[model samples]
Target: MIRAVPVLLTWVLAAGPAEMTPLVTEAVIQAPPEELWRVLTTAEGVLKLGVGAADIDFRPGGLLRTAYDPKVPLDSEAAIHTEIVAYDPGRVLVTRIHRPPKGFPFMNAYARVWTVFTLTPEGKGATRLRVAMVGYGPDEESQKMKAFFEKGNAWVLRELQAHYPGGR
Candidate 1:
């Protein structure tokens, strides 16, 4: 039987009362940080992990554009847009989702969401990856968005783990 490991979830409130809560998920991938870094930073690697075709420019303020549905033409207005907020090669990367796909349910309903990926090298060839989705407002729509991404981010991490079975 394949036992499933529960994904860890946490919440952090911003300093002020008006601040929104941040949703965090963490996982330990059985692969080197470098390999996972490539998956997160490169278009080809991201495509291999099933994030759809991507046009990634891996630098601060660069774009990581993706089309989630292959049925939708790449040039169509269905691509989701994210910008790199900060990055440190194989260690850390921060990105903000600035634009949702056209006609998305929550399009333009909430503030931009910041996703921070921190990779820490674990024992010989393992990496602990922590993904934080922040900047959610204290509104119903924002809470819905947070819940949506909490599951989505966890699935992305699982896909990354599957990409490196038994650390290859």
Candidate 2:
């Protein structure tokens, strides 16, 4: 006679080491630096890149809000809010996500996180775009958030690459 025993299966996923470090991703966009900068700074350009509808105030100490639903108001529950920390025309743009949507995972944990886009002319009619996400703390939540942004940013860059004219 044999007795059946119940078996339980569990899986746990982690974002690896808790060290505070910046996650950097880069891509060579087949567009001029000025055009790439416009894509990074303008609402229409962002919409073309498929991130969602954007309401961008492209300046230092300005607001950048994005919502998937165009009908939603900028301050509505569906929006993601970030502050423009700094910008150098056709060179760099820095933004910090100070207010993520309510109930978002690790929302409170991202108070210090920043996303920076740097562009440089890579020769005739091409630009090198580098994105760096910084200010992740040494904690599970921060690590998880960092990993999430790393993937998300990579997708954005890929989208930019695909959307730009002459990009392959």
Candidate 3:
């Protein structure tokens, strides 16, 4: 039997009570919401983004976990613990990262972070894809950590684009 691993959900308090600093990006996909949603909710689908393991339940209060390859050169593992904070089939998918993977320094030092994706209809055959991430960090170093993710998210979507023809 294929044992299911818990997926990472979104974390709303990573930095404390400070205003949520969000990194937002949007894309217009030729595919329908159903197609996009399918890819986003699948394990293989999310792996294409160059991250670690991804398993999300797609339902509220469900388990969500994402882990990166230890072989990667990045200082932090690609793993992120989260749960299905919210979901709207064919519309929005949101996950909050609660647990950071092992060997990741400073995993327990900050508030939590949450990621949200919204799909809007843009006509007869187009979909507007909006991805946003909000998390907390206590000190400047932590803030910088969040900043790193702010920038990395762009590349994350770019990787996603590669899966989409003409993304490069």
Candidate 4:
């Protein structure tokens, strides 16, 4: 009986944390890391990347507020607001959704997700850019969000790659 107790305790101790897999996308941008970092952290850069309008506070704990409609003012409730977390000048930028616009999907899951953007210098000044959406729980809503970003993030990465040489 004592041997069985030890075996059961060992099994329980051997169990690991819950599976947490991020949706990751990587591509080589034709620009250097410095240039790409600017594109990621500035309001003009956001607009150039096909976002309509942006008001960016480019600091840790600051906000990146954006609206998809050019005429929609940024202070309006229609804007999507994300918070800037820790960032390295030209290497990484981490952020999480602060306030999503109305009607945003997967409301139950969005609160827990964070995005990490990493830029690495590759051959000939090209930058290897990686985008990772992390912190997804194993719920149905999270699964749905996972499916949405699988297509959405890949498209954005492709666009960002094609958008190099100039941020347009």
- Number of the top candidate by TM-score? 4
After superposition, the stretches of candidate 1 with alpha carbons farther than 4 Å from their true spots are 1-20
Superposed Cα deviation of residue 141, candidate 3 (Å): 3.7
lDDT of 2 at 11: 8
| Global Cα lDDT for candidate 1 | 0.73
TM-score of each: 0.81, 0.82, 0.72, 0.83
lDDT against the true structure, per candidate, is 0.73, 0.75, 0.65, 0.79
Q: For candidate 3, what is the total of clashing residue pairs?
A: 27
- Which candidate, 2 or 3, would have the higher lDDT against the true structure? 2
Model 4 lDDT, residue 100, Cα: 83
Point out the higher-scoring one by TM-score: 1 or 3.
Answer: 1
Compose the digit string of candidate 2's lDDT tens values, residues 18-60: 2345699999988888888778788888775665678888777
| Clashing residue pairs in candidate 4 (N, C-alpha, C atoms within 3 angstroms) | none
Model 2, stretches more than 4 Å misplaced?
Answer: 1-20, 166-168
**Which scores higher on TM-score, 2 or 4?**
4
Q: Which should have the higher TM-score, number 1 or number 2?
A: 2
Better of 1 and 4 by lDDT: 4
Q: Tell me the lDDT of model 3 at 44.
A: 66
Please report, as a residue range, the 10-residue window in candidate 2 with the lowest summed lDDT: 4-13
Per-residue CA lDDT of candidate 4, range 25-144, in tens?
Answer: 887888888888988999987775567889899987899999889888777778889989768789989887888888888787887777889999997879988988877778788888
Model 3: per-residue Cα lDDT over 1-168, one tens digit each: 122213332123323554366768787766677877877777667786677666666567876566666354333445566667767787888776566666555564334566789988877666778888766545665676567776777777777767765564
Q: Top lDDT: which candidate number?
A: 4
